[model samples]
Target: MERILPSGFRFTPSPAQLIGHYLARKLCDLPIASNTINDADVYACVPAELDSRFPSLDRFQDCRYFFTWRMPLAATGARVSRKVGSGGVYKGTQSAKDVVDANGRTIGYRQSFAYFDKSGKKTEWLMEEYGIRRQVVDGTKDLVICKIYLTPTARRACDRR
Candidate 1:
């Protein structure tokens, strides 16, 4: 059956829906709707440049989401590397938050990161990375789903007519 959303409606999955449905389906090799999300190595470019790279994101003016394989940092043994993008790095601001399923079982983790320039100035870019908590299959441990967006301040300013 064809699943169609209302006109002008968007697929805004909550954090739990993201992990339990979309990300889980992807990892399990299940079918997801075509073009709902695209795969990109988001760390390679600044967030501002990401929307341009993925034309599918044209519908979303304030945020864009992508699936990418994050490399584990040797220093901290974390899934996301601190150094990413051109002359910039991503800094984690808080501890990983647990994503729970309907029965309250922890299904995944979510963490936020901010982009900083070479001079250590924080930019408007923010990333929310999500990953399954289960033991991943070999060679797929670093896979993650990321949602990139402008900071609230920047988003509000940009959205203002």
Candidate 2:
């Protein structure tokens, strides 16, 4: 039996939905209907290569999302790490934003980073990584969901006539 989405279907989901629902289900080993979300160490691969590997992203011209497990940075012990890909490393801009639950309690965080080339030139590729803030027994098993997309500046540059 094949399942299909209704007409005019869109996968637009809020930050809470991504972390609280999807990411939570993933960490709990629950089954998710769509196969678009895959497990990957997003920091290990360049954005372009990572984007090409996912078949579910063929329809999206703008952004691609994935579920990744990010280890804590050794220096700061923060969720955002400075791990470099084959090309370069990812540098986060500001601190992570708090993801609050319906009861006004902080549940998770959303952090954004920019990819830089080997020459130290910043690329248009950007990634938003989301992770739960709640304490867990094994930190290594924690999974963080990330959304990778081109910056608006890059999009405009590409669309220029």
Cα shift from native, residue 79, model 1 (Å): 6.0
Write down the TM-score of every candidate: 0.83, 0.81
Compose the digit string of candidate 1's lDDT tens values, residues 1-161: 23245667676778888899899899888998755666888878777788666543334555767888876644344354657668788889898999998999898999999989878899988988988865434334366788888888886787685
TM-score of 1: 0.83
- Models, CA RMSD each: 3.8, 3.4
CA shift of 160, model 1, Å: 3.2
lDDT of 2 by residue, 1-161 (tens): 13265655567777888888898888798998876566778878888888677643434456778888776644344443556677688888878899987778777999889999878999889988888875544444458888888888777776684
Shift of residue 85 alpha carbon in model 2, Å = 3.0
C-alpha lDDT values of all predictions: 0.76, 0.76
**Which run of 10 residues does model 2 get worst, by summed lDDT?**
73-82
